[model samples]
Target: MSDSNKTDFTNPSTFILVGIPGLEVAHVWISIPFCTMYTIVVLGNFIILFIVKTEPSLHMPMYYFLCMLAVTDLVLSTSTLPKMLSIYWFNSREINFSACLTQMHFIHCFSVMESGIFVAMAFDRYVAICHPLRHSTILTNHVVAKIGLALVLRGMMVILPFPFLASQWPYCRTNIIPHLYCEHMAVVNLACGDTRVSSYYGLFVVFCVRGLDVIFIAMSYTQILRAIFSLPTKDARLKALETCSSHLWAILSFYIPGLFSSLTHRFGHNVPLYFHVLIVSVYLLVPPMLNPIIYGVRTKQIQDRLLWLFTHKGI
Candidate 1:
C-alpha cells in the first residue's frame, strides 16, 4: 500500500525551472530584451518614486496612487526578474521548493497590490473630475495612508494561502516548471493529489480582483466622461479629459495583456505551452515597462519635471 502513495514532492527539496521551452537555442537572444526591460523597469520606477517624493506639486491624491503603483511595480519586478535571468543567462534553473513557494507568494501579493493601486487611481480620478471640491476632504493624507495599508493587508491575506495550498500537495509528476517564473497555476499543475479546490480558489481570486478592478475602472471612466461633457466650454472638456489619458493608458497596458493571455490559455487549445509561457511573461513585463513611459508622455507635470531635472542637474 505504501507503493500507492509515492510522490516526487514528498519533501520536494528542489525544482527544475524550464525557461522558454523549445527555444533553448535562442535563450541568449531572449535574455537580452528581458534584461533590458527589467533594467528599464527598475530605473523608471525609482525615478517615478524620486519625482513624486521631491515635487511638492505632485503630492496630491493622483500622484500618491502613482507612487503606490511604482512601489508595487518595483517589488513585483524584482521578485521575478532576477530568478528568470538566472535561468536564462546562466542556466541555473534548479530552485529549492521553499524558495520557489516564497517567490510565488510575493509575485501574487504584489500583483494584487498593483491592482488595488489602479483601483485607487480610478477613484482619485473620479473624485478629482466629478467632485473637485470634495476631492480634498475625501482623499486626505490619513485616508490615503489607510487605503495603502488596506491594500497591502488585503494582498497579504488573499495570496498567502496560494503557496501554502500549492505546497500541501504531493507532486509526483515532473518537477520541471515550464515557465520563466514560478506562477501558481504552473506549479500547482505538477501536484499528484487533488488540486481542484486550490485551482478553483485561484481562479476565483483572479476574477474577484482583476475582473472587478477592470469593471470599476471602466465605470469610473464613464462617469468621468459624463462630468467632462457637462462642462461649459470645449476647452474645459478637453482639459478634464486629458487628465484621464495617462490613467487610461496604464489600465489598458496592465489588463489587456493579462486578459488576452488568460483567454487564450483557456480557449486556445492549439496554442503550445511555450506560447502560453511567453504570454504570461509578456503579461508581467509590459506594465512595468510602459507605466513610467505613459506617465512621462501623458502627464504634463511629470514631463516638465523630467526635462527640467535633466537640464538643471537637480530637482
Candidate 2:
C-alpha cells in the first residue's frame, strides 16, 4: 500500500482499531461467557460483602480481610468487564485516547490494590496461624485499618507512575486497543512516541507489587503449613489446613495466570494473537468468577449467612 493508503500512525483522531483482523468472530464467542461471568462475579462479591457486614459473628480480622478481598474483586471486575462486554456485544470498539489511558490507570490501580489486599490477608492469616496467642493483639481493628490505608497508599504509589508516564506520550497514532480491555501495555504500544519509560514503569510496578505479594503469601503459607503439622491432634491440623485452603486457592488462581500472561507478553509475542487474546481473557475473567465461589464454599460462616439472608428474603 502507498503512503496515502497506509493508515496514519501519527494522527490519533484518524486511527481506528480494526480489532485483530478476522478475530471479530471471537467477540461473539466471548460475549455470552463474559456477561455470565460478570453477573456471577458482581453478585457473588456483593453477597460476600453483605454477609460480612451483616453477620456479627463474622466481624473478626480474618473476615475483615475477606471483606476487603470482596471489595477488591468487585472493583477489579468492574474496571474491565463492563467495557469489554460492551465492545463484544455492541461492537463499540472505538475508545478515545484519554479514555483508554483512564481505563489503563484504573485497571492497574485496582489490580495493585487487589495484590496489596492479598498480602494483607496473608499477614492476617500468618498472625492467626503462627501467633495465635497474640493474634488478637497483633491484628487488632486499629491495626487492620492501618493496613487497609497502607494498601491503598502503596497501590497508588506503585500504579500511578504508569499513567503519568503514559500521559507524557502523545498518542500521535492509533486509539484502538487490540484486546477487549484497555491493558497498559496494549495502550502504550499504540502510542506513536517512545514507550520505553511507560513499559519500564509497568514492569517495575508489577514486580514490586505483585511479586512481593506472591513472595509474602508464600512465606505465610510456609509458616501456616508448619503450624498445621505441628498441631498435636489430627482434628486441629485439619482445621488449620481448612482455614488456609481457600486463601491458598484464591492466591494461586489470581497470580499464576497473571504471571503466565506477563511472561507470554514479554517473551512470546511471536506466538499467535489468538493465543494472546485467549490467555488475557482467562487471566482477567476467571479469577473474579472463581473467587466468590471459592470463598463462599470454603468458609462456612459466609455460607450460613448467605442462606440466612436468602431464606429471610423469601419469607
Candidate 3:
C-alpha cells in the first residue's frame, strides 16, 4: 500500500460533529442564546485586553497575567465557536480530520494556558498581600514575561501529543463526535483501537496542569489569609483581603463550571445528552464572559478605567 492509502486507511478523511444529538430540532433555537453569549465573550475579553495593553499604569504583574488570560480566552473561544455556530446556523457538521485535530489542539492548549495564568495570578496576589514591600522586586516585567512564555510552552509541550495519539489509533468506528467542540478526549474516544493511552494522557495532562495549579493556588490563598489576619488593624486586614476578592471570583468562574462539565461528561452516566451538551457549552462560554465582569466589578483600576473610557469616550 502507498503512504497516502495507508494514511487514509488509518484515519477517516473527516468527522461529523453532531451538535446536541437528541436536540437536532432545537439546534436553531439553541443558536440564539449561544450566539448572544459568544458575542459577549468576544467583546468582553477584547475590552479587557485593550485596557491592559493601552494603560501604561496597568503594566504590572497582575494585569499582565490578566492579559494572558484574555488572550487565551480570545483564542480558545475563536477556535471552537466559529465551527459551532456554523453547525447551528448552516447545519454544517462535517469537519476534516486535520481541522478537527487543529481545533482539539487549540482547545486543550489554551485551556491549559489559562490554567497556568490563574496560577500566575494567584502568585501575584500572594506576593502583593504577603510581601508587599518586595512585590515589585519579586514580580518584575522580565520575570512576568518569562512566566507567561513558560506557561505557553508548558501547555504546548503537554498537549502536543493529543492529535498525534488520536492519529495513531485506527478510527474504524463511527466518526460522529458527541460533543459540540472537538475536545481531545472526544476525538480519542472515537478510535476503534484501544483508548486507554489517549484517555490516560488526557487525564495526566489535566492533573499535571490544572490539578497542581489548583493545589498551589489554594496554598497561595491560605498564606494570603494568614498575612491578612496578621495585619495590625481591622481596616488593614480588610484592605488586604479586598485585593484578593476579584481573583478568587475569577478562579471560581473559570474552574467550577469547567470541572463540573468534565466530570459530568465522564461519570454522569444517567445525564441526558442535552444537559451534558449544555454543560460543555457553558464551560466554554462562561469564563470568557465572566472573567472580564469579575475583574471589572472587583478591581478598582479596571472598573475606573472602564467608566472613564465610556464616559470620556476613551479620551
Candidate 4:
C-alpha cells in the first residue's frame, strides 16, 4: 500500500498554484492593479513597436534593440499575468504539469532575453557615443539582425534545461506551488529526489546570463561616460549624456526590482510569502509597463514622433 501510494504521488499530472498564500481574500482587490499594469504593458509596448516601425527616421540599431526589449517585456509579462488573473478572479489554480513547465520556460527565457537586449542597447549606445564615426559601419542592419538572432538562441538554449530537468525530477511530494505562477525553483522544490543539481544549475544560469549581462552593461556605460566627458564642450557632453537617459531609466527600473525579488526569494527567510509573491509579480509586470513611458517621456525623438503621430495622423 505504501509503495503504491508513493508510485501514485511520483510525478503527478497537475500542480496547484496557490495565488498568494496568505492573501487569498485580497486577490480580487489586488488583481485590479495587476490588470491595469498588464493593460498598460500590452498597449504601451505595442505602441512602441508601431511607432518604431512606421517612422523611417527611427529605423536605427538602437531602436531595433528597443523594439526587441519591448517584445521581450510583452512575452515575459504575458507568460504569467493572464493565469494569475485567472487564479485571482475565477479561482482557477490547477495547471497541467507540461503546461507549467512551458510557463516556466517562457518566464525565464524571455527574462534572460530582456537582459541580453539591455546589453545590446548598451553596446549600441557605446558605439554611437564613443565611436560615432564607425557607428553605422559597425552596427549595420545585418549585424543588428544577427545580434537579435543570437540573443534569441542564447535565451532559448540557456532556459531549455530548466523544463527538462523539472520534468525529470521525481515529484513524490505534494504539487502545491505556493505562489502565482510556476516559478522554476518552486516547481523543482517539490521533487523528492536530489535537487542539488537543479538548484546549482539554476544559480549557474543566473550568473552566466544576468550577471554577465550586468557586467557587460557596466563596461559599456563606463566607456560611454568616459567618451561623454572627453567631448570638447559642456553642451556636447550634455547632448551625449542625454541620449542615454531613457536607457538608464529602463535599466534601473528593470534590474532593481529583479534583483530585489531574486534576493528575497533566495535569502529573505523572514519575509512574508504574500509579500514575496507580490514583489516577484510586480517585478515581472512593472518594467514592461514602465519602459515605453520612460522612452516616450524622456527621448525627444520618441516624444516628437508620438506628438506627430497623434496630432497629424490621429494615431
Candidate 5:
C-alpha cells in the first residue's frame, strides 16, 4: 500500500492529528450533547460527594464507596472530556507529547481506581447481604480507609509503567492520534521501538487489574445470590435483588462497551474510521453520562437526596 493508504503504525518524533475525517463537521452534532453530559456528570457526582460528606445517615461503608466512585467518575471524565470539547468546539486538536502521556497516565489511573471502587462496592454488598449482622464490623471506617489507600497505590503501580514505556520510544514523525484522548495502547502503538514488552506488560496489567476486579464482583454477587435464595419469601428476594440492581447496571454499562472497544481496537483496526471513532466515543462518554442517571434512578437514597436537593433549589 502507498504511504497515504497505509495506517501509520510506526512511532514518529512528533504527531499531528488533523481531527478525524468527517468528524470535523460532525463536532457540531456532538458539541451540545457532550457539554450537557459533562455538566451532568460533574454536577451529579459533586452532589453525591457533598451528600456523602455531610449526611450522617450516609456515613456507612456503602456510601463511602459511592463517594469514592463519584470522585473517580469526576476525575475520569475531566481527564478526557475537556480536551475533547476543546477539539470539538475550537478545532484545537493538537496535543504535546508530554501532555498526551500525562493524560494517558491519569486516564489509566482513574479507570483502574474506578474498577477498585466497584470491587469495594461489591464487597460491601456481600457483607451487607450475606452477613447483615456483621456488616458494620467487617467493613469498618478504618478498613474502608485502608482499602482506599490500597486502591490508589495499586492503580498507580499498574498504570505508571504505561507512560514510562511510551516515553522510552523515539517518536520521529507523525503525532496525530486518531482518537480524541490519549489512550494508552494507541499512544504505545505510535512508538518506533520494539513494543513487544510494552504490549505484553499492558495486556498483563489490564487482565490483572480489570480481570481480578470482575472476578471479585462476580463472586460477591454469587454469594449474595445464594444468601438471598435461602430466604423464605418472594418479596424478600425481590427486595434483595433490588438492592443490587443499580450496581449491576453500572457494572454492565461500564464494562461491556469498554471490553468491546478494546477488542475491536486490537483485532479490528482494519475497520472503518467511523466505526472506530463511534466505538471509542461510546466507550469513553456513554458510561460517564449514564452512570449518574442509572445510579440515581435505581438507588432510592440517591433518588431521594436528588429530589430533596432539587426541591430546595427550586430547579
Candidate 6:
C-alpha cells in the first residue's frame, strides 16, 4: 500500500464521538432534556454559589462545603454536557485527541473532588450534630480552607495519571468512540495495545477516591445517627435527623446512579451500549440539578436566603 493509503494508527488527529448508539433518530428529541438539564445545572449551581456568597449568615462550614459541592457539580456537568448536546443537536461529533484527554481529565477530576466534598460535608455534619459545642472550633475557617485545598490537590494528583496513561496508548485500531464524551475507559479501550496498566490504574483511582471516601462518609453518618438518637427529647432527635435528610438525598442521588452506571458499564455485557451511555449521562447530570434543590429546600438557612434573595430581587 502507498504511504498515503496506509492507515496511520499511531495517533489520529481526531476521534469521532457517537452521541448515543442506536438512537440517531431521537437525537433531536433527546437534546431537549439534556439541554434543559444543562441549563438547570448551570443556573442551580450558580444560585447556590450566589446565595452562599452574599448572605453573611450562611457563612459556615456546612455552607462552605455546599459551595464546594456546587462548584464541583458545575465543572463536572460543564465538562461533558456541552459537547454531548453539540453531538446531539448539531451532529458535531469530532473531538481532537488532546481535547478528548482534557475533557476526560476534567470529568474524572471533578468527580473525585465531588466525592471528597461529600466526605467533608458528612464530617461537617458529624461534628455539628455529634459535638455541637466544638463544631465551630473543630471546623474553623482555617480548617475548612485547608480541607478545600486538600480535596483539590488530592483529586488533581490522583486523576493526573488518567489522561497521561490514556494518551500514551497507541490508538491504531479506530478513532471512533461509541459514547457521548471522552470517558477514561471509553477512550482507553480504543487503544490497540495492552490496556492492563490503564485499566488497573483506573480501578485504583476509583478505590482511592470512591471506596475510601464512601467508607469515611458511612462512618461519619453512623456516628451522626448515634448522636442524633442519644438526644434527650423526641423533637430534638427529629430535628437533628431532618437536618441530615438533604445530605442523605444528595449522597444517594450522586452515588447510587453513579455506582450502578459504573458497574453496568464494566460487567453487564448483556446491557445495551445505549443504555449504559444514557445511564452515565443521567448519572452526571441529575446530581447537579437535584443537589441545590435538595439543599435549598431542606436546609433552613439556604431556604431563608433564597426567599430573601428572590423577594428582594437579589439586592
lDDT of each: 0.86, 0.78, 0.86, 0.91, 0.80, 0.90
Worst 10 residues of 1 by lDDT: 1-10
| Model 6 Cα lDDT, one tens digit per residue, 61-127 | 9999999999999999999998998898889999988999999999999999999999999999999
Give the clashing pairs for model 3: none
Q: Model 1: residues >4 Å from true position, as ranges?
A: 1-7
Candidate 3 segments exceeding 4 Å error: 1-9
Q: 1-315, model 2: which lDDT tens digit per residue?
A: 234224464445422334444578887776777788888988888888888888889999888888887887778878877777777777776766667667777777877887878888888888888998999888889998999888888777777777677767766454555677777787678777668887777777668768888888888888888888999999999998888889889988988888888778767859887678668776777887788899999998888888887788882
TM agreement with the true structure for every prediction: 0.95, 0.92, 0.94, 0.96, 0.92, 0.96
Q: Candidate 2 — worst ten consecutive residues by lDDT sum?
A: 11-20
> How do all the candidates rank in terms of lDDT, highest first?
4, 6, 1, 3, 5, 2
Best by lDDT: 4
Model 6: ten consecutive residues of lowest lDDT: 1-10
Over 1-315, each residue of candidate 1 has an lDDT whose tens digit, in order, gives 134224444656777888988997788888899899999999898999899998999999889889899889988888888988888889988888899999999988998899889988998999999999999999999999999999999999999889989888888877788888888888888887789887788877778878888888889989999999999999999999899889888988887887777667556779998889888887787798899989988999998888889989964
Could you tell me how far off, in angstroms, the CA of residue 194 lies in candidate 2 after the best superposition? 3.4
- Candidate 2 Cα outliers beyond 4 Å, as residue runs: 1-21
For every candidate, C-alpha RMSD to the true structure in Å: 2.9, 2.6, 3.4, 2.3, 3.3, 2.2
lDDT of 4: 0.91
Backbone clash pairs for candidate 1 read none
lDDT of 4 by residue, 133-221 (tens): 99999999999999999999999999999999998988876778999999988899888878888888888877777899999999999
